[model samples]
Target chain A: MRKLFSSRTVVTIIIAFIVIVGLITGSNWLSKRTNTPPFVQRFSNDLAGGVSRLISVPTTAIGRTANSIGNLLDTFEENQILKAKIDQFAQDKVRLQTVEEENRSLKKQLGLQATLTDFKTVSAVTISRSPTTWQSQLVINQGIKAGLKKGMPVLSGAGIIGRISEVNTTNSKVALISDTSEDANRFAITIKGNSGEINGIITGFNREKNQLIMGQVTSDNTIKAGDLVETSGLGGVIPSGLFVGKVARVTKDDYGLSKRIYIEPAADLGNITTVVVAVSEIGAK
Target chain B: MAFWQLTRIRVVYPVILFFLLFVDGAVMSGMGAFFTAFPWHVLPLATLIWLFYGVQFDVDKDMPFWIYVTATGILFDAYYTGIFGTYTVAFLIATMVMKQAKNILDERLLSGLTMFLFGILTFLVITYFAGYIIGIANVSIVTFLLFEVLPTVALNAFFAVIGYFPVWSFFNFLR
Candidate 1:
């Protein structure tokens, strides 16, 4: 006993034991002693309740303040994010407005069709971009629910934009003709005198230049620069007589059987934010 | 010189805890922007910190321990900021576990070391689970681990360091 009391380890162990025992015994005593003299018990209960209230009040106040401050900071951060998004949308709105005005002027000048013939148009917003080497696709914020069925022709004011490949509840994926390996090509023949069929693949090669390439045209066909390339209506993918692009340059092959024609795409694929998806009129043929 | 005598000794530790809670709220809210996954929460961090502090300190001496534990839980579960009650349950269980562990590692130094280890481990598990549960696809594991655990550990340690002197003095005065 003397040795145990003399050591620091023993002293610490004893202190711990006493504390544990005291806590257990005290709790047990309180539980058992609840049935006591009425006045004395009432007074003790009131004191305990008052102490509990005192402890609770400050803790609750601090907690409320902490929560409010946290909420305030969150509100400030969220407001900043919302403000940034609004600014981006505002700039986009201005560009879109300019485009809309220019499109109205072009429509009045061209007088192509009163309502672009028969194709149904659905408005879609660009939402996301896929990361890939050659297969660049975009997710648009319109889906099957928005009357955007699969294989629908997408377009900007200039001409045919792309096609809807995938559809979801609130979004759809579009595969642009410019994406490498996409063979969304169709035959085009001019409507003027000496009309001849020309087979060319349409692709968006340079985004910044807004250029689409139409190659593999037969050398026998007399084609000129600025000749309008319209859908031959033969490919079954795109509608007949829809404007694709204009012939920019033509180069004869080694054998001279076919000519590779460079065509500038009518649609500006780079800056496309909103597009009109043309829903196919089933059984309209 | 006479500050100790003028102030109520009983209220000191709780007051310090209250102040630290405020700092914790601010720093964690700022960090939440980065730490947030799909569901949007910072409870895991708060729970981990509360547990570490409970385990390392003399929690047995905490008067009306349930009150503080409940308060910590309420503060941790600010889900109106996002989804509700995700943090409250986490903090309550965490503090309870730490209180149990405190019985075993009673010494300050040993408890502190254990607290640091637990702090790191809990942070990792919570972040991993947060990502998994919330379906945050495309973020790398290394990026998640570094961002989630490292900042929290550093921040908690910073607070602990600043708090050490005051805590020590208060305990010493009480003794």
Candidate 2:
């Protein structure tokens, strides 16, 4: 028994324990207290991103081929869908033209300037997604060197995907809207009713249904299914008017005092390859 | 002279382990992108594999092997973002358990396979629990076990099997 508790093993174990404790505390402090990622962390991520880009070429090719085959299989159905979309798009184009003219006239009459959402956009390609299951973060190739900043809104072709979580010199990480972590609850958004006055907060993501759960909605608000939801710009970082999603359904909360609206996200969060970072102008509110 | 030779031979392990870490972070992640449809989360558990290999081959239970395990764990934690020290502590505990159990377990292919499976399961459970305690993991136990744990175990086990022979041959060649 005495031999089992040898001084060497005891010392090693103690040292290991101290090291473990130090690491946990240090990392937590770094993540929470620091505004920017440490230089070592950024360098490592950039190096890994570069290597991942090189390794992704073959896999990207395979993915492209698989997508091509799937597209080919669905060509006839897609063609029909496209035909229907074309007619709808033609009508939308006319409506959009009239709205644009009215918007221009209103801006001229009011002498209003461009809003925060009218920032410059820089394109970026996803280098890798974090392997950890808890967080759904994507590392994009462009970073602070390209004028990307933390809290800047990221948009896909469809609509808003997420916001920049961390920015390094050459790459950045985007924390997806599906991330249900407590730190990820900064998105202040609103549901656009016919009256345009319904406001709610995106509380969490329903993974089973693949929907965003928006809660804190007043029972008095006449929100219904199919209402357009968007960022309220209430959170100073994210600009207003960025499309979030359509309300799939509305239900009473457990307390039955407020409503919880399930949103079908506009951007496909699961399968993103490229994104645009909306770089807000300096000092833009 | 004999001690010097042994130290020189053991140097290769750390080199190989570092290389594996790089490949796991860079290459394996990109490969995971291809399997978007399936719930296939392919993370390379090279450190776990190294622990298994150490359990199987290091009959003498050398100090260098333990150091390798510790260093690999620390490096993995440094590279991966999340609750730091989770992997390091998990790997250390796993190594200690394996070292204690090595006497009863025979040095054979079946034992190696069993150890590999058990090691991976233990490592993942520890990681999950540690992350949960640190407030990083928001996943429920059932969801984590089903979607993340099961797929990660299966994929990592496949990597361990494919990696076994080459690693075995390399260690032997180093000797």
Candidate 3:
């Protein structure tokens, strides 16, 4: 058994250790990068992405069907609630159409080709979510081949959930807002304050509290609870006017020097099946 | 004349592992309602099960096996975790430690179960710790142990126990 620790084996162990270190450092490097990952990895990810899609699509469908059937008991109550909202929804639909027409005509008169809110969307299915707890992520089937680019905002039916962090040839990785990693990018956002628009970055996630903390608020605007928060589109990547969530609470940071606004995400981070990748014209040449 | 025997072990084993990995993702995809409180459910370790299943078979932890582990680590990084080196290092160390433990313990059904469970612990610890160090993972040690480790172990152990005999017999047949 001493031969297990022989010179050759020791050398092999050392080499293995070096490889591990290299891999870890490489991963950290990739995390900080906003650019597309390596070509070979892209190609490999494409192939695996295809296989995973094949497996997850059917499996997820089957599971959802089972889960929905189990929820049949609640549907009656839910149906009553929906039925109550149908008349209100029809009125809102007409109002929205009128506003849309007015806005278009105004933009045409102004000769504006595009605005911060103008965007095209490519819909994709959530192929998978990472099983590990630390990093909250989703693998969507849409990738670079589908005109998806890095930093594109991924929205669920409710609101923006995450942004495309890594885009491969045929698949991409969406880093969810729930991630608390230092390396993850913060979403540039604005809160609709009573005084004016209060701007900040969605800087941190408190998983235990189930709230997203918005920080870097220099403005002492009178922000209150239940205020609307949405994308400011300060950064060119995400489109403007995407609904983020309602302000859950507002508090001072640990130092008590600045305000931190906590938002309850509108996107059902857990139940996202299909997502829309919003491609804004701001940075696209 | 034939250098290759146990064709099923060599070829079919990986195929099954692949599906297991996919199923792992599928389980998480559907468990969205419970995502806020507990994001992951039943993190199916195909490699760990592969190890458990092959305990009775003459499965060598050789160069090819190590390469497969390394490859799996890379794929895991790119496809799932998106953090490149975490699994490569974690899986390599865990597999090596698991093999060492196997040598020390007698090959009984209970022992095999113990080793399998222990293997899961080692893998989870190494992975969680590695991710923590890299500043990518955000779960506190206490939280990691309570939420991630507890559920994962319970479910994965149940899976191992349920599949142990059938998998062993299947491998036995392959031989």
Candidate 4:
């Protein structure tokens, strides 16, 4: 027994026991205690991001080259298909001009203020993607320098894109409205001829499918297929009357009072490159 | 063969651990350049330190063991941690406890695994806690376990097979 009482043996035993106990009970406490300093955390994050950018540049360039080569290998009819799309754009532009002129003439007749000038649009490009899929977030090139703030709305050319989640000095993480965990309420949405409200929560289901599901809507809203949904301006963070999506399928719950409408959001979220950040009109309550 | 003299062999393992951590950082970063998604997870280094001493029952040489333990903590802190130096304190506490476990388990594979597993687990918990303390990680509990723990365990196991022998050999030379 005396021989077993060696100083080294005793110390090792004491240390090991404490560590096991600490790990079982004090893991959270230890984690909270050892956070990196703020400045260091920010600097390291930027450095890591910058390094990743430098590393990815060559890879992206190669991918683009491959894609262009693949496109050239296709037959001539593919080119005709593209040409038709271009012609459609030309006709759409002419029609838009005619509508604008007609709208102005009608506004004069009704003496109403023009609404198109109300929105201030600033375009931005995505810089980084979150490593994990649990958080579907993107860091855009614009930041405080571009007049971006927390909760500012980001939009795809089609409809409501997301809201600014975190703003750094030169970049900001946009929490896409499609992100499932988000509890965003008060979406400024308008349905077809009703011109009233279609309210619910926005979330993303499958990244591969690139769809946004707006659920928990009221069964009384009279939502139907192909109805255009737009932002209602109730959140005050986003402007009123911005197109959000179209009602795809509407189903009632067990209670039959609340409806779960699966919205096919207007934005093709997967392919979005350039997005507009609503820098102005933040907090315009 | 003297009990007290066994300290010479014991000191070698800790020194090897300290040096490996430095190389681990540079190597992992360098590997990341090539693979882009190379499983480069930094599990707690102290586990191996604990297991090393835990297996080597003659590690009762207090002075040498503590020094090696402290060195392990410092190396881990310096290499992978965001704020730096915090891992050193956590590691020392972990190693000290491992020294006790060494008394019961003779230097063997099973004992080593036990210590290593504990070290790795502690690292995950501590680093995440550190993240919250510093505001680097604000993820929910479920996300943390999914993103941090599961991936780390897989990476650690992969590295363990490839890394263990070389590390053991280097430490054996010192012993």
Candidate 5:
């Protein structure tokens, strides 16, 4: 015991502990920051991103091939189901086109250049998602050169999945909606109910239930299960009318003072191969 | 040390770790795609890092590995977690723990599994607390275990068993 507790050894232990604490504190500070990282950090991230992008070309190809094969088993039935929907969709398309044209002309007449729903999108391949469950981040191949700014909402073919958390020169990280990290940007969402649109904020996720927990709802609006939830665009960060998901349930907080709504996310947060980064046209000419 | 041996330590090990880290990400992408319901993830790199110390290197040869461990942890934090010191501190301490743990457990398959559990468990705990301190992690301990730790153990233990022999053979070949 005395040998183990030698003066030199004790000094070393204390120094190591201090170093560890400093590292944790320093890293935590860096982790929460959204600005451009140090040169060393950027260089390292770029190098890794380059490698992942090179590898993703093959991996994503293989993933899609495997996915198509899996979908083949259900294709016949899905074809039958889709054929029926296509006819209905064809009629809806013409009606939607007419309505859109009228709305566009009316907006032009009103001298409105951009609205909350105005945005442009850039497509990018997803190299990978962070292995850790807590992180819930996706590494995309486009970055600063691609005009991807921080806080840009990312969408899969299905719907909005997350927002850009970090941007490097050739790559960016999207913090997924499922991410429980405190630094993650919260999504301001609205649920279309029988009465009207009920607004709320996405706060956390219930991993066990596979549901997104929407909180800070002061409204007692009649929100039913299966109601379409979309970005309200109240915050002006995320575009309005972007499909988020349908309401899964409405429950009370533990204190019973506030309402907690659970959302079944539209995007398959589990499997994302490609995404589009939504660049808001808020100030764009 | 021979020139070749030094090269293996300085160059080969880091190169191999880089690929292994990439494999973790690649495996994770496929796993997320196919096994959507299975939230348990495999950290082969974490297991491999432990194998580098606990099973392969005697403590005397551990000096160089500290640098490797630190570099690897920093890259992991920068590349994936974005929380720089979380993996660095966790992996560094786990390697220190591995030195003691290696003494108690032989380098058999079962022992390798135990070490993997030790390495990953320590990583989760240290990182969880670090995340908590940094205000990132919000899940309860029970949720962490259920969602993160248990599934990682289940998958990575099998990975540890299968990977142990190859890594052991490689280390012995280096010897």
Candidate 6:
């Protein structure tokens, strides 16, 4: 038998180690210089994502069915609640229609053309969530073939969910705002106040509390609880005026130099399956 | 070369590795949605099963086992999107260590379990340190161990216990 400490085996091990370390550092450098991953890496991701989608469909369906069956147990209570809210919904619908018509007329008089916020959206089903806990990301069944590109905003039924991070030919990954990973998921958000707009950046997510922490608000801003927060469009890729969430509370930042706003995300990010990728106007960024 | 040898070692082995990669990338993650309410996360490294098989059955001390480990690690890094070469290096080191230890380690249930646990622990520690050094992992070491490391180890250990015999039999059958 060949000796365990043979020169050939030792040299192979050392060379392998050096090569892997080189690859690790080299790939990181390449990825940083180019915003997109290399094509080979992307192709591997696509292959895995495609196979995963096939396996996950039945699992997702089973989960949904189980949830539906559980919900059936509370159907009567839900029906009663819906019955009580129907009249209130009717009144709000009429009021909203009137306000929308007036707003459209005002916009016509102002002669303002449709803005970047006016986007064409394509729907995609989420194939998987990232298995790692450190990052909050979703793999969706849409990609460059579907006109998806990096930085395009994604939304669920309630509000904006995240932005597309990497796009392959047939699949894309979205980095959720809740992810604490460096600058990738940061959002420039505007909190609309009766007097003026309060601007802040969503810095991190308080996962324990299930709220978004928006910081860097100037102390002079007249921000308050229950104000609506939306994308400010300052970041360029994300469109202006996509609803993010409502401000749950206002607090002082760690340094007390500025205000921190806690936002309750409008979308039930925990239970999202279908999402819309908002394809914004070209050259808007 | 015999047809059965070519098919088993070249075709079936790589196919099994690819399937495991798919399960790790897609199926485990799809299942993660159901565990959103849980505080701790459980990431199952299905590839570890194959790695263990490589260590146990690689009687010739050939290059195929190492090649499979490297390819599996590369595919994992591609799908995971955390750090590019973390798994590649970790898997290589783990395989090397396990290969050296195989001389002393017996091929039995308890020994198999111990081997798997040792492999997984080394993989996790190495990957975690590499990720932290590269700025991919930002959590404190304590928090990482509590939330990610401990749970992952436990889950993968359970997989090792239950999956060991079946995987062993399959590799034997292939031989």
Worst 10 residues of 6 chain A by lDDT: A27-36
In model 2, what is chain B's TM-score? 0.81
Candidate 1 per-residue lDDT, tens place, A1-285, comes to 356365788888788656544543343234224322234333432333233233434433554465567668789778988987998899999998998788778878998443323356678655333221123345566764686655667786687767765454455656666543232232333322145656555533543233565555554767677777765544454555666678777677568776766676677554454678865443124
| lDDT (tens digit, per residue) of candidate 3 on A1-285 | 446488888899899777777777777676567578778778877888878888887768876786688679799999999999999999999999999899999999999988888888999998887777567678898887898887888899789888888888888888888877643448788889889889878888877666788886768789998999899888787889999999999888888888888898888787778899889987565
DockQ of each: 0.08, 0.31, 0.55, 0.06, 0.44, 0.39
Best by DockQ: 3
Reference-based lDDT, each prediction: 0.50, 0.70, 0.76, 0.54, 0.74, 0.74
lDDT of 2 by residue, A140-187 (tens): 889888977777889986888777777778888787776775445457
Interface quality of candidate 3 as DockQ: 0.55
Isolated chain A: TM-score per model?
0.50, 0.85, 0.89, 0.66, 0.90, 0.81
TM-score of 5: 0.89
CA lDDT, candidate 6, residue B25: 48
**Least well predicted 10-residue stretch by lDDT in candidate 6 chain B:** B29-38
C-alpha RMSD values across all candidates: 21.9, 4.5, 3.2, 10.9, 3.2, 4.3
Which residue pairs in model 3 clash with each other?
none
How much is A200 displaced in model 6, in angstroms? 1.6
Model 3 per-residue lDDT at A35: 72
Q: Which clashing pairs does model 2 show?
A: none
Q: How much is the lDDT of residue B53 in candidate 4?
A: 41
Which residue pairs in candidate 1 collide? A178-A204, A212-A265
lDDT of 6 by residue, B48-152 (tens): 767777677672353466677878777767776634777777887777777777777897778767777778778878876775555556556776678767878
Off by over 4 Å in 2: A1-26, A101-105, A194-196, A282-285, B1-16, B25-83, B91-103, B173-175
* Top-down lDDT ranking: 3, 5, 6, 2, 4, 1
lDDT of 5 by residue, A1-285 (tens): 347488898899999878877877786577567556677887888999888776666666777788889889999999999998999999999998999899899999999988997899899988866766467788888989998877888999778889888888999999988777654547888899998878778898776676888986778678889999898887676788889899999999888888899999899876788899988888233
**Evaluation by lDDT, superior candidate among 1 and 4:** 4
**Native contacts retained, all candidates in order:** 0.00, 0.24, 0.57, 0.00, 0.39, 0.35
Encode model 4's per-residue lDDT on B1-175: one tens digit a residue: 7665654555455544544443333332223222123222223232454344434444444346666656555434322332234466566655545555656666666676566556566655655564445333435667556645676666655566565566566446545
List model 4 lDDT by residue over A1-285, tens digit each: 459588998998899756644543353334234322245444544544454345444534544455467557885879888887998899999998999799778878998753422457778765444322223355566765677776777887787778776555565666666454332222545565354555544534433234455656663656678888776665556776677778787777568767666667787554344589764443533
